[model samples]
Structures are given as C-alpha cells and as structure tokens.
Target: MNRTEAHFIAQDHLAREGLLLDRLDWDAWLDLYREDAVYWVPGWIDEDTLTTDVRRQVSLVWHTRRDELLDRVVRIRSRKSVTAMPLPRTTHSTSNVLVESAEPGRIVAAASFIVHEHHPRLRRNDVLFGRYEFEIVQEAGDAWRYARKKTILQNDLIPTLVDFYNI
Candidate 1:
C-alpha cells in the first residue's frame, strides 16, 4: 500500500485504541496489542533525555508481556486495585498522526495525544499530553496489532497514579 493508505490505517488503529480506552473496554483494548508486545513509558532522565533502558532505569509504565497487562486488568475488574477504584472517566484525543515508515509486514506511526481524566473519588480533573510511537505489525487476515508502543509524556510531574488507561 502507499504511504497515504498506511497513514489512514495507522490513524484508524490509533483512534480505535483511544475509543476502547475511553469506554474502559479493557478486553478490546488488550486485543489491539500482540501477546509479547512492549508497552513502555520511559521516565525523563533530564531536560533533554529520557531513560532508555527499562531494566536499569526508572519508567512510568512498562509491561514486557501482554499477560502483565491482563493481570493489571484483572485487578481493576476485581476491584482489588485501590488506584483503579472508582475509575476515572477519560476521553482520549489523538492528532497529527504520521506514518514514519511502512513496509510489507510492519508500520511505524507517531502521533500527539492528550487524555482528559476525571477522578470520581477526588472530584478532580487532569490532562495528560504526550507523543506516542507505535510499531504495528500485520497479522493474519488483515489484522494489525501493536508490537511495541513507546509513550513519551511531556509533563512528567504526574499528580496521581499513572496507568495504561490514563496515558
């Protein structure tokens, strides 16, 4: 497919991801990712650099396997997670989607995103803005799944708990 076509596909995929998260549909959201996908949000090391190594540096969020995400979902569903209790209502918006590269089986896309979240318990609202880089791979039967997701949060001074859903 041409770059334009690839851009549309990537944009659609990202929009669907945002919709799933907004609805708090954990199962469907999880479906967008591969089993061994890497979901990472690196912490800033300084004014200009971010932590590159997950094993040795601090990260806001990192799950090497989808099962780890599933475990977190389970906790949220079971009401066992205090941080997730009275889950925040969120709306995710993404813009400026660009297809960095598109090959036969893989596509790399990047976009800017902002998620507005309202905490039920705290009666507070917060917004998180960041840039997302996704490595999406084509699977069987026209399926596309996130092979790796790198989220770069511009505002690193998060006031509350940070999870996959919020940013």
Candidate 2:
C-alpha cells in the first residue's frame, strides 16, 4: 500500500478504537492490539524522551502487555469493585489526527482526544483530555494491531479520583 493508503487505514483504526472505548467494548478494544503492546499514560510531557525509571518519574498508568490490560478489565468487571459499582457513561471524541509517517507495514499516528464521563451517582461530568501517540502495524491482510500507545494527559500532576472503569 502507498503512504496515503496506510495513513487512511491508521486513521480509521484510531476512530474505531475511540468508538469502542465510548461503547465500553472492552474485549473488542483489547483485541485490536498485539500481545506485547505497551500502553503508557505518561505523567510527564517528556516522559518518552527521558531515560529515567518510569516508576520513579511519576507515571500515571502503564500496561506492558495485553494480559495486564485483560486483568485490569476483569478487575473492573468484578462485582467487588466498589469504584465501578455505578458505571459511568463515557464519550470519547478524537480529533486533530495527524499521521507522522508510514513505512511498508507500520504507521505512526498522533491525535487529540477528550473523554467526557458522566456519573449520576457521583454528580460528575469530568472531561479528561489527552494526546495519543500510536504505532500501528499491518498484520494479516487488512488487520491492524497497535504496537504501542502512548497517552499524555494534559494535567499530569494533579491528584484526581478516577473510577476503576475509566479508560
């Protein structure tokens, strides 16, 4: 495929991922990634550039593998999770999409997203904004797998209460 074709495919993949998250399709969303994929919600803007220990560098959230992500999903789905007792309605809006580059089988994408969450029980309509930096690879035929997803939150240092179900 050409660069334009690869970019279009990557953009579509990101759009689908946003929709899946908005619908809370955990299983389908998780399946869109490779088994060794890394999901990082960095605590600092330059976390990627910094070579220091992520744990010591104030990382927000990090999942090194697909199994870890699955575990988190399972934990949130469990009945014992108090934080998730009253599920919140979430809508993810993604925009400002830019495809940085495209190789033979890989595409680099960047986009801005706002996750609006509303929970009647908590009387909250919080908006979580971030930028997504993704490395997507074409697998079998038209299948796309997320090799890496780096989410950089707008407010990284703030101590905020996040529901376990929030993604």
Candidate 3:
C-alpha cells in the first residue's frame, strides 16, 4: 500500500482504539494490540529529560506482554484493585495523527491525545495530555495491531491514578 493508504489505516486504527477506551470496552480495546505487544510510559528523569531504558530506569507503566494488560483489566473488572476500583469515567480524544514511516507490513505513527477523567468516588475531574508513538503492524487479512505503544505524558505531576484507559 502507498503512504496515503497507510496513513488512513493508522488514523482509523487509532480512532477506533480511542473510542473503545472511552466506552470502557476493555475486551475490544485489548484486541487492538498484539499478544506480544509492548506498552510503555516512560517517567521523567529530570526537568529536561525522560527515562530511556525501561529495565533500568523508572517508568510509569510498562507491560511487556498483552497478558499483563489483561491481568490489569481483570483486576479492574473484579474491583480487586483499589486504584482502579470504581473506575473513573474517561473520554479519550486523539488528534494530529501522522504516519512517520511505513513499510508493507508495518508503520510508525504519532498522535496527540487528551483524556478527560472524572472520578466519581472523589467527585473530581482531571485531564491528561500526551503524545503517542505507535508501532503498528499489519496482520493477516489486512488487520492492524499495535506492536509497541509509547505514551509521553506531558503533565507528569498526576493527581490521581493513571491507567491504560485514562492514558
């Protein structure tokens, strides 16, 4: 496929993923990622730098496998996780999707996102903004999945819990 076509595919995929997260459709949202996908949110090292190594440095969230994501979802669903208990309502908005590079079976894309979150228990509202770098891969039958997702959280001084749904 051409560059334009790849961009469209990436845009659509990202849009759908955001929609699912906003709807709290965990099952469908999980489907967007590959079984071996990497989900990482690097923490800031200093005022000017972010952590570069996942293993050595601190990270906000780092799940090397999709099953780890699934485990978190299970905790949230069962209300077993205190932080995720009474899961906050969230609306994820993704924009400025750009295809940085594309090959036959893979594409690298970047987009800006804002997640509006309302905590019912605390009666508070918060916003998280970030940029996402996604390594998307075309699977069999033209389906697309995220092979790696790196989220850069701009406002790192978080007030509440941060999870996959909210960032």
lDDT of 3 by residue, 84-130 (tens): 76888888888999999999999999999999999998999999998
Lowest lDDT 10-residue stretch of candidate 1 = 154-163
RMSD of each: 0.9, 2.9, 1.0
Models 1 onward score TM values of: 0.97, 0.86, 0.96
Candidate 1 per-residue lDDT over residues 1-167, each given as its tens digit: 78988998899999999999999899999999999999999999999999999899999899999999999999999999987789999999999999999998789999999999999999999999999999999998898999999999988578778898898
Between the candidate structures 2 and 3, which one is better when assessed by TM-score?
Answer: 3
Candidate maximizing TM-score: 1
Residue runs of model 2 more than 4 Å from their true location after superposition: 45-52, 156-167
The TM-score obtained by model 2 is: 0.86
Global lDDT scores for all candidate models? 0.93, 0.76, 0.91
* Model 3 per-residue lDDT at 21: 89
Candidate 2, residues 1-167: lDDT per residue as tens digits? Answer: 67678768877887888788778798998888899998887665463552236767766678889898888778767855666666678787778888888888899989987877887677867777878889998788878999998876775443245532343
